[model samples]
Target chain A: MKSEDLETVRMVVHARSGVAVDISKEYAIESRLAPLARRDSFADVGELVQAIRARRDEGLMWSVTEALIQGETCFFRDREPFALFRDDMLPALAARADRPVRVWSAACSTGQEPYSLAMIVDEVAPRFPGLKVELFASDLSERRLEKAQSGLYTQFEVQRGLPIRLLVRHFEKVEEVWRLSQSLRQMVRFRRINLLADLRALGQYDVIFCRNVISSLDPALRGRVLEQMAQALAPGGWLVLGQDERPMGLTEALESISGWDGAFGRNPAFRAAA
Target chain B: MKTCLVVDDSRVIRKVARRILEELGFEVAEAADGMEAMAWCRTAMPEAILLDWNMPLMDGLEFLRQLRKEPDGDQPIVVFCTVENDLEHIALALESGADEYIMKPFDGDILSVKLMEAGVLA
Candidate 1:
């Protein structure tokens, strides 16, 4: 792909999905789309881009967008954050409010985050007895969201991060692949959400994990996206960011906690503004 | 028989490690998360712990930090078994008092070798 064409696709992806693609990673982008390009009988990504610009093929455009978005997710992507959520966050949230615990995995990209959250809640649910916990998972890509809803993972995806017991308990192995049980699959409600857009309609959440998805936006867009996130977070609710991502300038309502990467709201006033 | 505590939130991982440890002749105990692991530590007093980095309640790092504060800080050989494959993350785990670091999707042989090196297995 030419540098100009790569730049154009990057801009379009960012504008539509809020996913930032580095200019240096043009080859990766081209390789990802090469199959689609060939399927459409285009010689290369350059021709594909030309075809997309003609606005004659909506299907090709969707395919290109899907190709650009990295939906590479595995169960329990990072172990520590989930650990924190299970040990520190969940109990804290349970104690702070008498209502049902609500969690939103924003940009949940293929459902790993929410499904992982559900597994944690499932493990602890017996202890809580009557406490209700609802998990909501959303992504900008409808294609990804549909895959998330299916709760099916290939052997490779199943192998990473998932423990053997969970594989046996929550999933059934069909040949080499694994499919999540209905019980676990039903725990999360998957939806299509544009994080850069208004999120107030989604309602409040006790914990929001918008990890790794926001770093691609411009700083102003990042701030606006976070503000929309802040609107959905309940007071004392936790926001988990990517390892290198910072929420410092994102929202004033959140105060950085000692150990976790991002901040927590000590006061519940932030969501009240929603 | 020697005893080892496998402290991880993932049941699949715990089971795999337990099988490997048990095959190597160590009796294995398990905890679903760090808090449960801490509770087990108070009573079980296992000779070693195979910890996972990310968990729901208290993560392995926080658990290690808290465990090190106890009076019996040096009681167990704490080895972090996790998917945080970055070298810097491994260094951080060691700096946090983890006796050894094992990355995830690990081979059973590698696990056994690490256990032997840590003296949890012969």
Candidate 2:
């Protein structure tokens, strides 16, 4: 937790993942890395940092970064965004549908957001029969992606935001735990991709949910990430951010729509004028 | 407090549904099967019923059919809770007088939404 070690950890983390760690969060680094150091046969966090500095192991560095990254999430974490998606966004997209709708849940830690989206799409599928929907979810951590792929959740995990109706409908009880139905599981394709890296390979999306991610990055990285997300959208596609996050001065391609809480549409006028 | 009857053959599901319904502010009663559920209905009608599709003695559709003819039976909003996913069975349940349908392995949010949509919970 020394200043120099903190700086090194920060440099390595930001260099690889673009996540900014404040000096005040040195305690968090110590706490998260202490056990990792112990498991790796090191005496303490300092030793872990020393090893990383000495060897510069890419896998070990990634482990440190992933451990430092917080994956706090829940199914339908907030009601408002989902309500907006159900009431406004889906219908608008339905109207403009010429092909299957592609949705990406960026930074989709443990897969709740995209799975929640799949449930909504399933519930509304009867209304728009034959409207094929393809879902893709991505995260920076391979560990979290593995958990997401398993589709298993503990009792306490399911208790958060997941309603009993959905729990019973889309999930099967696995002994003491719950597992998402295979049908729901297959709806999402999970991948490990850092938001700071080239996202064009993921292809354009009709709707993107990049919530609670940009706010954690440094301001400069935040602007770059926002522009990348905007560029990933289809011509008039939607990009949803964490409820309190915004697009002000980050990108000209996106315009915050009036009366929409956390939703932004691609700026057709700006594209037209250009 | 509003009361709801949870009718399912499985005690585990009854307990799970009971916990969620109580959390949503509804007083809950349980019946192991359709016959027992109908008996409970005869004594005191619940405001809503989370009925299972398959059960001993009488199934959910049978209970729905018989309950609609009984006095005060039409009062309880019925939602079919089951693992059956076939569209044909769902249509049959709707035709037999189900207010709503929710698949098995549900949690609090899905239940709350379905109940809210069914006008069972405010």
Candidate 3:
């Protein structure tokens, strides 16, 4: 692809979704977008870029931007966070006078993270007695949101980071694919959302899982998103970042909860309570 | 290195599994079927057993049942890696003394992680 094309695509992706594309990884970027070009009947990436530069097709802009956005997610991508959700977060939220605990999976990619959260809630719901947990998942890509709502996963996806025991329990074999049971699918509602937009209208959540998301944002947007996410959390609600991530001095509203990896909260009492 | 018995009817699966298990630092052994696995276990018990379901001359579940009767059979961590994917199948394997369950089409990472979960590897 031409340098101008590369720059244009990178800028569009970064501007739209806050995902910064590394110029050095041009080969990876081309490989990911090549299929999109072919699917759209473009002979090659250069022609695709030519079309994109003309800005004739408005849909292609979103397609390329969505394609360029990274969507690497699987069931329970990291194990420790889910364990904390099961043992600590669920109990704390259930203890609150709030009837239905609200959880948001921001930039949730293909829905594995939120579905995993729902599975945990379903497993422990009997103990809570009339427990109601509302799960909301969102991503920038509409295609990915559709797949997430489908509740289908490949054999490899079901096994990756997911305990196989839960695989048979929560998912049913559908020919070559595995579909997460309908009840679990109903537990999550997916939406096409941009993190850069106003989020207050979505209301507050008891737990917000924004793992591996804001870290990918351009430096300017990180602080803005961090503060907005902080405001969106219910009082004493936890914000779980990526496993290896910290707030990095972006915002003072979040403080790390000791022993809970990648988990932060407005209230310091989360540690004492957990 | 700790010893692990790799039992499967498929030569290709056994070969692939042996490679991955060896890569995870296990001294690997192979058995074509349950009776053969049983015969091998009587002489020298391995620290771990990767059993496959639906093998000839006795299947994994029966082998596990028979193995539990042996003096130190319960010592080896039994993990069934097979294509038999159902809640009942997994539950039965656990009820029959298996330590772990991995569905077929596995990779090195899957084997390494499952073995670690079984407490057979650090």
Candidate 4:
């Protein structure tokens, strides 16, 4: 509400998540933080701001950061990318059969993207025989990861961007919501990860979905983050961003894959043999 | 606009489905049971049929079997929207020529997405 509180919220969110909060959308920022404010027994955004400014509670700060940066997502949020993963990427990986294929859904808010990947793998991987596809999903929010790991979704949640056929196949009706089958749930490993940190500990991925993530990063950090992602990708690996986004010639390590929209191929020169 | 026949015994369910389909720009028709659906089809075939299981006189499976035997019966897309959630039930529906299946207690969005998936709606 006040100028000082506005700048404080902006600084905290940006420093932690690398997401730039628009001061112009003051109502949006307040709306996003309202629930968190209530949870901490604060009346409104102003009080929540004062709490953050005064306290060194790491947990509260993380919660506030996630509240601001998290996004609304659904299963198979976009049709074409899942189609690409199912038809083209899986076939290519299945052909190899030599090494395990690791796919990461980074900034995987509430786990839809990775779970969607698991649904495809569950259906199609059987045809290939012995194709080991390991799926890793991560978000900066511990809260989101918990929900993702639980494999539960409301009727509304399950309905969005999901065909009824797959819903019936992989999820069992639970009261008013649907619980994803244990098989699909177990297929993915969920973790809380900050992209601004060193990602090498998560290991290199053959196919990484950093979709809708880098576009939100502070412009100052975009190039550095892209280079870090480049190093974390295996040679000839794939990196999928949001359909509307690209590297925009930010770094040479990643190049747009011809014919593939919003997908980049890792250049071998980016990282030596490991 | 394309035509869709809602085949269900429940008036409330039919009404609910009708409201949703109408909003999606489909010319909606109603059938109380499979026999009525059959009669309607014999007179004028709809582009799509939202079928349900467990009806008076003729059930959904029997109707599907009989419908396929009719001339130009394969033309209309059939989607089973029922309380049947079992794999065997789904498999049987598919075997009996259901293009898609939706479980009971679904909402407008679920119905909408399923219809789109069946190519009955854009």
Off by over 4 Å in 2: A269-274, B1-122
Model 3 regions lying over 4 Å from their true place:
A267-274, B9-12, B43-45, B85-95, B116-122
Could you report the DockQ of all the candidates, in the order they appear?
Answer: 0.04, 0.07, 0.47, 0.36
Segments of candidate 1 deviating more than 4 angstroms: A56-59, A261-263, A266-274, B1-122
True contacts kept of 4: 0.41
Tens digit per residue, CA lDDT, model 2, A1-274: 7788888898888898888877687787899888789889998898889888899999889888988887999888776788787788888888888898899999999998989999999888899876788999999999999999999987667756765556667877777677999999999999888999877677899899999998888888887788778878987788999978998876676789789889898776554221
What is the C-alpha local distance difference test score of candidate 4?
A: 0.85
TM-score of 4: 0.84
User: What's the i-RMS for candidate 2 in angstroms?
Assistant: 7.3
Note the clash tally of each candidate.
Answer: 20, 16, 0, 0
List model 1 lDDT by residue over A89-186, tens digit each: 88777676588899899888888889988999998877767768889998878888998999888755655666544555687756545689999999
Tens-place lDDT per residue, model 3, B36-81, is 9999999999999999999999899999999999989989999999
* Residue pairs in clash, model 3: none
Point to the candidate with the largest DockQ.
3
Candidate 4 lDDT, tens digit per residue, A78-192? 6778888888888988887688899999888988899999999988967988899999998988889999999998766876778767876888877767899998999999888
Model 4 ranges with Cα > 4 A deviation: A268-274, B6-37, B51-69, B80-96, B103-109, B119-122
TM-score of each: 0.68, 0.71, 0.90, 0.84
Candidates' C-alpha lDDT: 0.78, 0.85, 0.86, 0.85
| RMSD of model 4 against the true structure | 3.6
List per-model TM-scores for chain B: 0.94, 0.97, 0.98, 0.97
